[model samples]
Target: MRQTWRWFGPRDLVSIDAVRQAGAEGIVTALHHVPTGTVWSPAEIEQRKREIATMKDGSPSTLTWDVVESLPVSEDIKKQSGDWRAHIAAYKQSLRNLSDAGIGVICYNFMPVLDWTRTDLAWRLPTGGTCMRFDLTDFAAFDIFILERPGADADFPEEVRAAASARLAGMDGARQERLARNVVFGLPGAAESFTLEDVRRHLAEYAPLGADGLRANMAAFLEEVAPLAQELGLRLCCHPDDPPFSLLGLPRIMSTEADYTWLINAVDLPANGITLCSGSLGARPDNDLPGMMKRLGDRVHFLHLRNVRRETAGIPCSFHEAEHLGGGTDMVALVRAALAEEARRRVAGRADASIPFRPDHGQDILDDLGRQAQPGYPSIGRLKGLAELRGIIAAETHAG
Candidate 1:
């Protein structure tokens, strides 16, 4: 695998120099300052490239902006509503500009409303480290009592609703507000930011679009974009829905292998691919990480290699980010599978043989405890994860 790190532009607390020190060969980033559905001017793209390529001393950092974490598909495009056609044109233009700039892979998600949902930003662990977590009862409390969405009661089981009521009752004003904020926090540096009102309004817009409708819309969007990606020699990968399930009554179209199979076949383009986020898909007990990698390896363009430990066997059960190798995933088996895939690609002379993968999220430990870096992206924690992954890769290569 080609090791990479995600940087949120100049505003990110984790600097490029720090990423270099962490031993990442490439940067996975985007024009986060640009709003959604807007064109990324070549000047802006060049400026970001210069920022990543040049150090503070006007010397070369020797780091390339190899992958764009997202060029951001607009919500309008997702629903095929107002201005969606315009947004699609802008998206194609962005891809052309990126290809001209020598950036080849783009990672985007089709999840409605929120990108990735978590109930807590910094849940404490037994080791005194803090990691992101999703508590079923806490989320139900937010969905049922706090947001007060219409028909929210019908979404959860009666027992879950009862527990949520108790959970909400124990919370004072400040706690209740905190829970709401965390749920809608959105991506750390992306254009989407939401309040309770914004979320509720968006939910209303998606009320009629169930899983089938959303999936069809996504297919339509891809039909337009995937052909363009192929023409421009760009790889476009859709990230799996985080937690891989329905949330807040929103339809989750890209969650399971069946979903991927349908989308891959629907678009029927090689450039249309998967991001293969282990932690997100692994949240569901039914997903087999190594099996998915082995079966879907040919279509995987980017990778987020992290792990999660489920608290129970059920879907939508509570879970927290665990150490890379300590979670429910078989890290060793998954790593071996990735290596095997790369070997196959090399033999076939594929251009993207060594997939670009980043050490996704990490626990807040050591210097990260007080650095106030973005949630789940603490510098030291990720360094530890990269080091561990590096060791595994080295050992696997040697053994092979």
Candidate 2:
């Protein structure tokens, strides 16, 4: 596997030098400033590449932009709504631009409204470090009392709904407002922030589509773009839905193995692939990470190797980001599976034999507390994760 790190461009609290120091061989990033539906100009792409290669002090960092974390798939395209066709054209053009610039892999998700929803940005762990967490009750509270989405209570079980209600009732106005802010909070520096009214409006737009309708829209999108990706030698990987289930009554199409199978078979192309995010998918207990890697290895163009411990036993339960090796997925076994898949690819003489992976989310520890970096992307925490993962890979390689 090619070890990469996600660097949120120039404004990221974590710098390129820091990424290099963390021992990452490649950089995974996106032109975050570019709006969702807009084309990523070749000039903009090249400028980013240059920025990644050159440090703040004009020194060569020698790091190449290895993967595009997202060439964003707009909600317009996801719903096949207003100007969706134009967005699709723009998406294809972005792919072409990325390919022309030698960036062959693009990772994007089709999750409507929010990219990855979390109730708490800094949930304290027993180890005295803090990691991002998603509490089911808190999310339900947001759904029921805060955003007040119609029929929101129907989405949860009676017990869950009651718990959410009780939680909401106890909280003061300040806590409620804070929860709302965190729930709708967007990625820092990404063009995804949303106010409460903005979310309500977006939810209204998605109300008519439901789950099946949304899935069909996603399939239609792949049918148009997958072929172009294949021809351009670009591997377009769809990130699995975070938490892998319904949220705010919106359908989560790419959550499970079956969900992936549906889309992959629908498009039926090599370019149409999966970004097997263990942390996101592992939130669901039934998602066998190692098995999925083995079964879907051929189509997995990118990997996000982090872990989460499920707080409860069910589908829509709570989960928090755990250490890379200590979380739900078996890190060592998953690494071995990845290595075996790479060996198989090498034997088949494939061009992209080595899949690029990054330490997805890490706990905020050591020097990270004072730095106030992006929510889940603490520098030292991710460095620790990368080191641990690198150790696993080394052991696996030696044993192989």
Candidate 3:
């Protein structure tokens, strides 16, 4: 695996020097300044690349930008409404431009109405600094009582709804506001934020599009773009649903293995692939992480490694930032499967044998919280994760 770190470009608090200090050679980033549905010109791509490449003293660092975390998909395209064809065309052109600049992997998600959901952004950790976590109760509280979207209460069981209402009743105005912002305010690279009215409007747009409708829209979008992906030697990897389930009555299309099968078969293209996110899918007990990795190994172009702590019946599952080798995933089996796939690719003389992976979400520990950066992408936690993964991979190689 080639280690990479997600950077939000020049405006990001985490500098290139900090990324290098974290032990990653590749940077996964995007042109955040550019709005959605616009073409990313080659000049813009190269300019961002050069900016990251050049060091403080005007010398170049070996660090290279190899992947784009996402090139935002316009809501118009996802809804497949009027003028979406133009947006789709522009999206393909962006892929062409990115490929021309040698970016081969693009990570994106197809969750309707939201990206990753978190109840608390600065959840206190035992290590002192905070980490991102999702609590079912917190979300239920939001859905049933806070946002008070029509029909939201019906989404949860009666007991859960009662608990949610109670929780919301206890929360003060400021705490409730923070919870709402954390859930809907859109993390830097995850999704775009919308005002309360804007969210309600977006929900209205998807009201006509159910699970099947959203799936169809995704397939149509891929059908138009996958061919270009193949042409440009790019692997388009769709990230799995964050909670691996529906939220606020919005459909989640890429939550399970069946969804992945549906997507690849719908497009019928080799360039279409999966960005295996362990923590997201692992939130659900039914998903077999190692099995999914083994089954989809041939098509997985990137990996987001993290872990979540699953709870028993009444308890809510909280996402803890775990070491790569100590997480909920069967790290050894996953590593073995990934390595086997890489070996097979090498045997076949495939050029894309080295897949790029990064530690998805990290604990906000040490000096990372002191400095301002993306919430979940703290330097020390990720550096620890990368080092753990590297050691595991190295040990596996030696054992072989």
Q: How many residue pairs collide in each prediction?
A: 0, 0, 0
CA lDDT, every prediction? 0.91, 0.91, 0.82
For model 2, the stretches where C-alpha displacement exceeds 4 angstroms are none
lDDT of 1 by residue, 1-400 (tens): 9999999999899998888888899999999989999999999999999999877777788899988988888889888899999999999999999999999999999999999999999999999999999999999999988899898899888888999999989999999999998899888798669989989988999999888889889989999999999999999999999879999899998888888888789888889999999999999999998999999899989889999999966877889999988899998898889999999999999988999999999999988999988899999989999999999999998954
> If ranked by lDDT, best first, what sequence of candidates would result?
2, 1, 3
Let me know the TM-score candidate 3 reaches against the reference structure.
0.96
User: Which one wins by TM-score: 2 or 3?
Assistant: 2
Q: Which ten residues in a row have the lowest lDDT in candidate 2?
A: 184-193
Clash pairs detected, candidate 2:
none
State the lDDT at 188 in candidate 1.
79
Worst 10 residues of 1 by lDDT: 53-62
Pairs with backbone N, CA or C atoms under 3 Å apart (clashes), candidate 1: none
Cα lDDT of model 2 by residue, 209-249, tens digit: 98899988998999889999999999989998887998998
TM for every model, in the order presented, reads: 0.98, 0.98, 0.96
